[model samples]
Target chain A: MITFSKQQLKIPKLQRPVYLVTAGQSKFDRAFPDKRTEELCIDSFTMAAQLLEISPAELKTYIHSCYYGHFADHFGDQLLGESVIHDRLGLDPLGNIGVKTGGATGGSTIWEGMKAVASGYSDCVLVMGWERMDEVPTDEGNFLISCAADKDWESPLGHIYTGYYAVMAQRYWQIFGKSEDSFRRTLAEISVKHHGYARFNPYAQAPMDITVDDVLNSPVVAYPLRALDCCLMSVGAACTILCDEDTAVKLTKNSKNKPLRLWTSAGTHTLRPADRMDMDIPLLPNETADQYKDLGERFPGGDRYPGFTGFLAARVAAHYAYGMAGITDPTEDLDVVELHDAFTISDVQTYEDIGIRPYGEGRTYVESGDCYHTNPNTGQPGKLPSNISGGLIGCMHSVGATGIMQTFEIASHIWNRWEEFHGDENIWNKFNRQKPKDWTNLQVVGAKRGMAISHAGVGSHVTSTILMDPDHLINKDA
Target chain B: MSMFGQVFVKNNQYKLKGDFHHMTPNMPIRNADDEWKLLGVTNPRAMTYMHSYGGEAVFFESLSQGKLMASRCDNSDCNITGTIYMPFRIHCPDCLAKNSVFDLTDIAKKSATIHTFMECQRSGAFNLLDKPIKFINIEFDGVATILMSYLVVGTPKFGMKVVPIFKTTGPTYTILDLAWVEEGTKEEQLPEGFSF
Candidate 1:
């Protein structure tokens, strides 16, 4: 008889000292008539290289692997472009990965990079995500997003992306008895807050100051979800440079900056529509709900189960990352957070899913104003400030690039470099009363840790990344 | 040829089996959510591929038809199918599919439905506009499949079922050849040389 040993039963720890040292992004905009996917990625790559103060050539040498996050054609050319960049820089990479995860492409790519580094397979990896929405016609884009749903059932019913989410939104209303006005108010607050933050983000796509009424009165795309409540499907790109610990120190020591350590990373998925029947209705206590339930039993656990979709995956992934990183209280332990706010409801749902609030209470977190960069309800200061960099709503979603963009934002905030590049003082002023001019002066706030949550819109993908201040590296003594 | 025959010929044809193992309430074994979770953690790459393919079908459906349509539910609620992707069946997708026979005779004359649709500017071959094409979910009086098609018009409103006009020439004589829609008023009769 063959038996497994306890030692073998354990999952191996990441051998390399991976550090998310530098991150960069391109300006997000509505798909322009002239832009192409290659151009967007090239621009994002250039920005990423510039931020690291490294030439494309230097980056090539250190990059053991590369992953592309996109959902467009020209897959061959996209890979060739990376190779050409490497060859031009005189660096030979061992592996090249071109993975597409619908809207979760960016975050998925980042997770892949982190996995490569964590698995002791590679020392340094470069993850790039880009999308050129303007290159295609509007009908085509709609078709692309809709494709994310069940083509046989939902597609046959003419269920567009918004309508799909609207059904869920409507179901939530039925169970919670929340009025359309309440949903609108919550969405408006989120949109307005993110827009205000976007004013400082030069790379953001649709930055505007609008009232709650604007959101309420916005064209109803699908009943409760107004135009403003939804995120803009724009074109953009983002890149991150991750390396092992020794390499990070060597590079940082040689440079003038500190590196952001990779605390942990995780991803999870749940049931699709067909599988929903096996799920329990009225969501029994300790019994999680999948994507489907009888309309009558849609809202389970009331305040305990937040109505937002796609949190199960995110929450599961976050649990693993927190456990790995030794983080117990995410709200108190993490200094900053950035979530995939594809829609206003997503942000609220994510809060509860991530354990920040008790289910139905996500709205209270938003309404009480404790979730914002500046707290309104309690003058005493908020524990966690989420999506401060405008999130997907303000930043624009380039499908595959959206997840990575959220990760990059969280990494940048933790590193305290957003103000330097964007020249936006609001984030610093709101979070840090007295802004520090340089990275060193930016006090390592209360916690030396931070976390990020990313999810794909089709309601299938979820990933979480934990970033720790390099100073808090647990194995430094080793 | 009739609209039904044309669509069947134009789009890529594949047979999806109902024989595949499915999660049902009686089984009570494992749920789709559990399977999704397992797949998500253990096979993220596959999940990504699944989603990417889902995105691809949207473009395929649009270029095939000038109008959008969805499948009707054959089960209990008669509610339209929401997020369940292709090859999976759970009953009624749109108002129950039982005893319902779809006819495409009046597809060209029916007004387009806007309640289920989106404007897409990415994916597939065509790049006619600066932004993505306006994809609409049009429900006609005689079709079982809610045709997913493109809207030549700028903005679409709910309950508007515009008529589909096909292109004169194309390798595949699919519904997508029905290139644009005639807006403002629903056509009372079929065009010349057309039959129900």
Candidate 2:
């Protein structure tokens, strides 16, 4: 398994074009004591139907099958939770299956649905994901999250998942970061940016208008990572419907939306990061071997591939996705992205992994003002805005629902309905959250293409979901 | 008298003893508002799992005997033969051949160095490690993969020379039975139940 064969490295191709017609999400919060998971799911499905300008029952008629993504049965204390949800959603006497790939469950669910539509097995498939973390307290929730790790090897250490990621942050800090004060500040700036963006997102769980000072002063969960740097433990549901070209066109005929092409490609590495072997960097289309030849010389202790400083799975996923979508460079080809920012430091790592920035220089992506809604340097739009939905850090890390939530965020931008969904006074009132006076529209103008990267523990599983306007594809046949 | 759950394998079948689960009544969770209307209930239960280490059981069992066992991929037909795995792989990843187990204690003591490390301030429920656990990933001279363990004494930095310490007195038969500390430390300075 050290060296990949040509068969294993082949770029995936869909048999027929697949499209994401519509998507929706429920209000995300750390806990939802008043509502059950099924109720939240119904809310998301109802919203999806509303987007299509159809009744929930009318939309249900188009769903030939269902793919449910509920990561932790332990958290819900229910076995076959997918069936329970399927029954509650009233989609019975139809084929349905469950998908679980840790935090990537949502993306993986959509991936399953995409394949179903691509192969013509189902014309339209319902991809719904939800998580109920409210049932357990904080420490117990952390315990359950830690169970995703190698039970015998890593889980026995402290039963804390943060400790597992903290080791990587420490390595990336000293090596790539050079343990500099500016680099630490750059990490804090990410927290400041995400939390600032959250104030505009009605569904975001931890909205704040905090400064870099506040993030730096926040209580340290681990050195180099503060509480503000971590993603939220949330409860919510999100969903998207995928269909073949015919079904997509029909579904969006009357609605103001258009069918967007969706291509999902996935990759995985060792569950235990310790087992990740040193390998050649799986270069993206935009990268060349000469660029990383001196990586070790520049950073010192940075040449180790898939080392604690990097995520091989993310790099592999991006490699497949870029190839499938004909993206030579993500910075140019893709307008926006929603990366799995489990930690602020991991967010920076993903920038390099996904080729938004070169290795040992992920800070440049933030420093250059390319990842913001608007460049702080100039009043112009940022070249590549990421996590406009506040991402997992400021938004919600509702595990199963997170990737679907991210898809909803990016799809809304492509649909040019960002202000409609996020800035609507009705939604703010429904959630009982007061909209900020200075709420800004984060819609990426002329966004023809976007992507959402869903990831699991320590680079174990990752999927890249690329959505593009059918009229504008880098590879026409794609 | 109530006893905790325990199990053992006999003739390829698990034999259980004592109570496997303890159940408690569900308590109503009533809202303080709206005249204390019932919202939900809390379900409380205590359970223990009988986990089998399988082929890697030797690695856990050896910790109590003051030995570190590593597996060698001896599949001659494999691409990466003779590669040693420190976390004790039961089978060779390249060829799926059963790995040959060998004592890695001496090499670990003489050549182990910290590859990366972290000091964690928080832990989840049911964790046995003390607060501020000094987590360290160790690299050996010839091992292919790093081994994640904890430093029992002294702060950890990159490439700090260390040796493994075993909880030989009262072993938990788990990874916690093995720990690490700086080299040249006195035997008397070791933690209770742990020794060089």
Candidate 3:
């Protein structure tokens, strides 16, 4: 009964061009002693401010508004962090926003910040997502997350977060006949690949040298899902500042730097119980129809429904990002991707959902190594190297913090800033700008058309497509 | 709906004596023949009467003890028979005028049976238990009203006979003195600790 018309749904048009000028994250860990949520937030914000070469006071004046995305501990007292940092650094803002979308809170916050800039409501906005889940006991933390689902029907039925994903796994097996062994192999490979990437990440929580065998042999928590298949419970924070193109130049010139332009971002919500639909039926205004109709038509099948990992809502969101970015071919166009791998099954599901592989063919993409860090089959290289920053498996999923972590990783990779800590220096140098020490050197390489996709662990699915022009790195392309 | 009327009787006089009064001989009728002749000779315009007395008085006087009891028809060929009584009583009301005899005893006091039970979570002043309570109905030795009370056992099972124990708190004379029943044998029970 409650619906929005096209005109009412339309967000206000912004006269100024927006750009993702800066992004930063704190060290991901299981717990930080004496670390409050506000401190973690301030830590992330301070890192971004430092990266932009601007004091919090100078940046505060430019920030028209601010949004915070967080769950678990210190939710009601979030302003304390903003006020503390504001007082310490002497910064003030015109408006502030807070979004709590269960586990997807971080991704939802990014979408909120993007909309605020795109709508011309504010010329610049600061967005941050942080969580201190480790402060509570594990069961209590899980209870908080489970609160996101339907309490009466789901929780009372002893449905944990894992059980929700387990149902999806069961459905996948029933529909595609994908055996548990195949799922295990794909999951193990995904975990090992992310862990290998994490070894290069200084902020990853569970960075380790794990193997496919390790993931397969790990203890099974739920049927078809082993211990390695699950993401680590992490405590950390991530932050980003968005500014219009003209302001970005003035600020860049004043600070002698470049900016990450604001690309198209899209978000959609499907019916809560995704399983209620017939498998063959198409989800309306899904990522494909909503964002990628042209690409859907271009494919030989003439608009086929993409089957995804039905666990997390991220797959649909990632698809939407591909569409909004006008990516006709993911294998040829997309250079890097980051997905919320809350569980191993999620990574496999994401592969199919994001159109990296055909329906029921995500396993092949993994086996072929196109979705891995190192391609063993082609000897050429993987195309869509996914969850390269160890993902939720290595990075730890502090429900509220994981989504933004994915965005920060993609932004960092596209900016060519990954090698400041990990990965091959020469390889990263190809994507890096000429000025190695300069912050602008973090820009994406030959990335005239770029897209970043993120799915919230909960039901809020959002895909953000960021289109950046190397020429416009210093100014607005439009 | 059955239309019925009641007329009270005190001694040998009809209490309803205003418009339809009746006179009776002071001498008591000693035999059924004399009682039938007295009833037949009553004027058509005279009011009829029935005597009613509290069951407790007869129970104490006849049985000399508090008891759970029932009533039975004294007629020789009556199919309509035994009906359970509460607080004990003498004489079956159904056959009182016909057979004119009554038996008062404590037959049920020697044994008890469980009828049914239910578990409940509601609790308050109205509930016997101050917390989540379970109610059970036991057909006690010689009482009616099923001796309803809260079950004291951790777990209650069907067909479990429990003997009723009385507590003298609040108003002792009231039936509220009857508390929960517990599992025990007749040999383990004792008479009222204090005289009523």
TM-score of chain B of each: 0.37, 0.97, 0.42
Candidate 2 lDDT over A1-478, as tens digits, reads 2788888889898999999999989999988888999999999999999999999999999999999999999999998999998999999989999999998999999989999999989999999999999898899999999999999889989999988999999999999999998888899899889988989999999899998889989987867678998999999999999999899989999897889999998999899989988898888888999999999999999999878989988898888888888999999999999999999889999999999999999999999999998999887999999999999999999999999999999899999999999999999999999999998999999999999999999889999999999889999977
- Show model 2 residue runs off by greater than 4 Å: none
RMSD of 2: 1.0
lDDT score of residue A409 within candidate 3: 67
Best by TM-score: 2
Give the best candidate by DockQ. Answer: 2
Residue A133, model 1, lDDT = 63
**Model 1 C-alpha lDDT per residue in residues A127-194, reported as the tens digit of each score:** 87777666445655665566666554344233357655664454444344354467557767898888
Model 3, span A1-478: residue lDDT tens:
1123466334333445567777767767876644555666777777677767787667777887887776653323234444544444344545665676666677777778877887788778888877776644565455555555543223322224554554445445434433456655766887887776666666777766778998878865544556777778778888888877776776666442357655544445432342121123233222243444453343332222322234224444543444344455566666666676777666666666656665465677778887765577866546667777778888667656676777666666655665553443542343231222322122233333345455553335555545454453322323
What TM-score does chain A of each model score against the native chain A? 0.82, 0.99, 0.80
Report i-RMS for every model.
10.5, 0.8, 24.9
Q: What DockQ, on C-alphas, does every prediction get?
A: 0.04, 0.85, 0.01
Off by over 4 Å in 1: A1-12, A32-36, A74-94, A254-256, A263-271, A277-310, A378-381, A424-447, A473-478, B1-196
Worst 10 residues of 1 chain A by lDDT: A276-285
lDDT by residue (B37-146, candidate 3, tens digit) is: 43222112234334344444343333223332344344565443444443233544434523233342234334555443444432111212333334444454433233
Model 2 chain A: which ten-residue window has the lowest total lDDT? Answer: A1-10
Q: Residue A300 lDDT in model 3?
A: 31
Q: lDDT (0-100) at residue A3 of candidate 1?
A: 25
What value does the lDDT take at residue A228 in candidate 2?
Answer: 90
- By the lDDT metric, which is better: model 2 or model 3? 2
